[model samples]
Target: MQTYPIPMVPGPVVVPEAIRQVYLEPYGSGDLEVEFVELVTRTQRRLKAIFGTRDDIVIQSGEGMLVLWSALKSCLVPGDRVLAVATGVFGYGIGEMAQSIGAEVKTLGFSYDETINDMARIEAAIAEFKPRMITAVHCETPSGTLNPLEELGRLKHAYRVPLFYVDTVAGAGGVPVLADDWHIDLCLGGSQKCLSAPPDISFLSVSPKAWEIIDAVGYVGYDALKPFQHAVENRYFPYTPSWQGVAALYAAAGLLLDEGLENSFNRHDAVARFCRRRLVEMGIDLFPAPGAVPSPTVTAARIPQGFTWEAWDRRLRAEGLVVAGSYGPLAGKVFRLGHMGSQADKELVTQALEVIAATLK
Candidate 1:
């Protein structure tokens, strides 16, 4: 087998010792694996600590997309309009999912290079459309922009019309997301990005407000189809969970908690800032707007006119470094470096930048 130097790909970067220990533990469906239940509990508890939410949490056995699709199906009703703020590929996927379930979807969007629609604009759209649900992505990884969660929360509370659902798949644990404080009804997260876990588990923390609305609507009679409480109660998924994947998620969750949320966030922020600084110093231009909110987990840079992103990417790989290609509108024009997962720290970022600098020269 050929040995590779360093992997800077977006996910599955590296797993911590504590996380590895949890993965190595044996499994059983009996009382011996009762500790496995603890894994689930601890994962949720740690999430609550980070999200600052006491709301009900559900750990699903799939990627972030699974949770996103499930939440829309379970909550959104036929003919109900959903206000989707599109900024990237995943944002568009949310609208498509809502429409598949008979939702009258209306998108309030911007170009991939642009940031989110302003809160004032969102408020006006809400008043005009009177949508029953609002979907927003906290961090648009493809563009490296952070949406204003607090502002969105305030607008939702004021309108009191729609349920606010946030997709924080790349933002959670790395950025500040106060689910309870923001009064967001639904929030989804993934383990692979910021949590540094194997890519198998996704989680959602459902607010009481959402539960109340769900209970009042009272079973539309299709309990089997719902994703929130449905899959959990049934235990077998709509299909079987990756048992080993769950173990990995639990281990990763434990490691995140041990480092502590504040510390984790600070470390990520430092690395991102360092990366941005180095890129600018290397005469590279960032894609995101200056003075605007930026994603702490990923940084996107526009390739210089004479240099194609692929050429630079290939050169970096030859020097034993790896990064990601942009998605959708950004493809071929920009390259992204993820400052999340186990490698989301100063040491990893510094080394990665060093390799990039050598490649550029």
Candidate 2:
């Protein structure tokens, strides 16, 4: 059997050995049905706690993009205006999804090296477009920029925008995101990122106001959130749910809670600081401009002037370390180092940096 390299990529992070054991157990049978239901219930509650929201939460059987698409489909109808804030690849992706669903999409873009920190510009766009819904990515993983979502959330409330959708897929566990405090109507996250679980499971939290809008739209399908709503309300699986994924996520959540959310955030903060310090000591430049808030979960740095990411990345992998490269405008300019969940440990960060320094040399 081939052993996987230490996963330091931005997502599908290294799962804890204890959590991986959950996968070895057989799927729930008739005798274990109630136990499985309780597990799901506990997972949902813990997810809401992690999100810092009391809103209805759903665990879906797909990647984070599924929850993002479901939010757009459930709330937006033809002719509705959507003002999407694009700071990086995933931010631009929100506008693309909105447009694909036939909503009139307007984007407020920022340079890949900066975050959308200007509330004035976002507010101006909202005023000019009069959008029914607004989308923002809390952390643009590609750029390693963390947008000011609290201010934007407050802005949305001030504008009386019916819905505020946020992609916190890369932010939630590593940083602080109070969905209720920020007035975020719809917030989505994935088990793969920061949560330290395997891929194929995503979760979302929906506020009552957003639920009202979703109900009015009345869309129903495999991708719709309606079935998830029914599942939550009726306490049953909407379809054949992924019990293994749920269990894994549940175990991960328990670990986070046991560690304490504040401590986890602090740990991520320390890891990010350590990584940046090491990079600077090596005479490397970070991707985000000065004054731009970097993501606590990942760090994006420019590749050395003469070294291409393809060759450097391959070299690092040969040394048994795995990092990520950028996409979109940053494809060749930058590479990403993820410091979240299990990979956020000091030993991992130090080892990855050692591999990086050697590869670059």
Candidate 3:
């Protein structure tokens, strides 16, 4: 039997065989304009449902980091204050990006092992910093931790913060996102993650308040939201978009909607539980503490005492399973098991775990 490498990484997950057909379709036909418009429109509607936002949803032609940067760049000018809440590597990276944009960035950082659920500290930072924008990552994939975005969103509203941003790249389909109800002014996601698509497109949902700020600032070039807004209003793209990626995402969104968002999230939860249980049975300790909220998209576990991450990772790859290694403070000490998108299934997860069990024994 012919075998392929199984990707258990967080993003750019395994694409469903059905969606792969989208790539084989021809591009640049006479119907390209009409077909692309319909694809974009349908994808935007499905994205709104997934993010739970009634606001503007823009699909950008780049990785998730591009949308993250665009969201921050559009809203913030030099000297604007931003309060970034960091629980893991990706959460901290948001703050770094803000700083690069010349925003006055202050991070309220928690330990890697802890979820960002400390409301008291967050409140103190909000009161002291009086930031124009607040940023957080809903699912910190590297540490397998989930932040309390609902509580953070409530705090943002209570304080009347002008802009509130959430990076849900790893959380979008696998977890619940109440963007409108929770007062998330800007929410970002990537197709490569829980959407189960290739890694070429990122998306953002923009609220009216955030749009007003963006319009006033008037950013330019590829990083600007104005061009995307123009494209949306006129039903044309700002620049040449990756039609292949667009088609693939359209098909992927169909798969997600057909399965229903709630059902998809429930499947992720069940798969995560199964993965965690199997890891425990294999005598591996999970990274996040018992009380902390762990991410349903991925599971972070401590590497076995006798083996290094490099050694174990090599072994897993040799067995045709490609898991992820940790970053930041946990580099080489922790390994991650991704159960997102199409990979969040009992059969696939069981196969990967069986490999781990055999290799470790």
Candidate 4:
């Protein structure tokens, strides 16, 4: 496999050596050790801090999508109603995932380059649709967009929606995701995006109301959340745990907290601003539509006018810089520079931008 000096992808980013080393050290069996359970408990506590919620945190062994599916299945039975607010690939995709599970879904979609800025329209849907659950993505990574949820939280309560779900897989540590304050019942996040950890761990902050619905649904599967409720306290997990994975997650969360969440947010914001300014100075067009909030974790730009994505990607790779291409409707038309977690450093972004400039010239 080839590696690049300037490594910037949306996720599964270059894991720092501090986190990489945890995988090498030896430990007792995950299923038998009490110490492992303690590690999970501590990790859960640390994640609660990151999520800014007093709710219980469930740390499961898998990449982010595992919990996304689990959360929907655990809470919804066939014929349940879901209102999915969408702005990009992941946003619209979540709505389809719900439909696949036999739920009746209504997708409130914006352009791929847009965001969920029209809350009045969303509120009307909630008032009329009165769905059982409302789903949204906090950061639409593919489009480099961020949707404000505070008002939706207000709508969730005002309309008495039973479950308000969100996927903050790309924004949690890079930006603010106030789960409790926003009244989000099932707030989903991953280890890879801003935590600088391996993509082996996934977590969610489950509110009491969501848990109640989960219990009543009685869904049982590998991704099920019910077994996890007391799995930690009883020293028996749903499956064999990954002690190294959990420890790396624990360490990763600590790294962000040590830096201070607000400080981290500011760093990501500054770097994003710098990246966009440099791109504009080079005459490159950004992808986010007018009025859409660009994500601090990533910057999406249109492919150079005369260059196809394939050619542009090859040129950058030849220069030893790596970035990501967009998905769905954005494929080939847009590209991204992920500046979150360890890669959020301003110097790193400057270097990445330099490569883009040189390639453009």
TM-score of each: 0.90, 0.96, 0.96, 0.99
**lDDT by residue for model 2 (1-361), tens:** 4344656888878888988998998885721477777778889899999999999898888998889998999999999999998888988989999999899999998887888777888889988899999999999999988988888888889999989999999998899989998998899999988889888899999999888888899988777887777664466665777888899999999999999999999999999999999999998999999989999999999988777888877777889888889998889889898898888898889988898788767
- Candidate 2 stretches greater than 4 Å from native: 1-6, 30-32
- Model 4, 256-350: lDDT tens digits are 99999999999999999999999999999999987889999999999998899999999999999999999999999999999989999899899
Candidate 1: pairs in clash? none
Tens-place lDDT per residue, model 1, 223-322, is 2123445543333344445556677776676677778888888988888889899999998889987656777888888876677877877788788778
Model 3 stretches with alpha carbons more than 4 Å out? 1-5, 29-32
For every candidate structure, what is the RMSD over all alpha carbons to the true structure, in angstroms? Answer: 3.0, 1.7, 1.9, 0.8
Greater lDDT among 1 and 2 belongs to 2
Top-scoring candidate (lDDT): 4
Better of 1 and 3 by TM-score: 3
What are the lDDT scores of the predictions, listed in order? 0.76, 0.88, 0.89, 0.93
TM accuracy, model 2: 0.96
Model 4 is weakest, by summed lDDT over 10 consecutive residues, at: 28-37
